[model samples]
Target: MKDWDYGELFEAINESYEEFLANGRGEKFAVARAFNEYANMGKIEDIITGVAIGEILASHDKVFIGYIEGITGWLSEVGKKDLKNELSDGEIENLLGRIATVIRDLRNKPIDSNPVA
Candidate 1:
């Protein structure tokens, strides 16, 4: 086994995303015919929770929740409430971009100094 590589990981995740769109649901209904199975188990939550924040973060959810509350307060200051509802596909793009940037920065920095702030 060699050292881990994130470029490969990113490619794998993108492939999963492509698969998500291929056989995706478009059900028939009198009132609605829309994309289904796109919001449930194939969600980005598990990826974010497990990798971006690390599994150890689950034990620090309270601390992270408080941090998120602080972020919500900042959003409110910018006239945005219910941020989750406001977020669109753009949010996913932003998260992916940030992940790539953070990974790049981390690779360039020394481990003992904690590049992940």
Candidate 2:
């Protein structure tokens, strides 16, 4: 297994987040479509390639809703009202965490030493 570059991962996450904001309702859909295209060509990291599919497979809105509830609680406790949205920032953030975890976990999986390209 190779060491993962945390900085690079963070940068990717930032880029993805910007994409989400730009696309709004189609955010995850867009990421999933792009990720799948790359994964099919073996051009993306495995964990990232799997995220959207994971949510789709889980098939439960509540799981995602819980994420929002948790975030709302934190914001309320701190008196930061703006971060607490009805849609659940915590849930979306949880998805982000899942994305991060998958990438980190992929770093431990056996992979071809050569770049996919």
Error of 2 at 52 (Å): 8.6
Q: Which is the leading candidate under lDDT?
A: 2
lDDT of 1 by residue, 62-111 (tens): 22333233323332233123224434556545545554443443333322
Clashes of 2: 3
Candidate 2 per-residue lDDT, tens place, 30-54, comes to 4444444434422123333345433
Best by TM-score: 2
Clashing pairs in 2: 67-90, 67-91, 68-91
**TM-score on alpha carbons, each prediction:** 0.27, 0.28
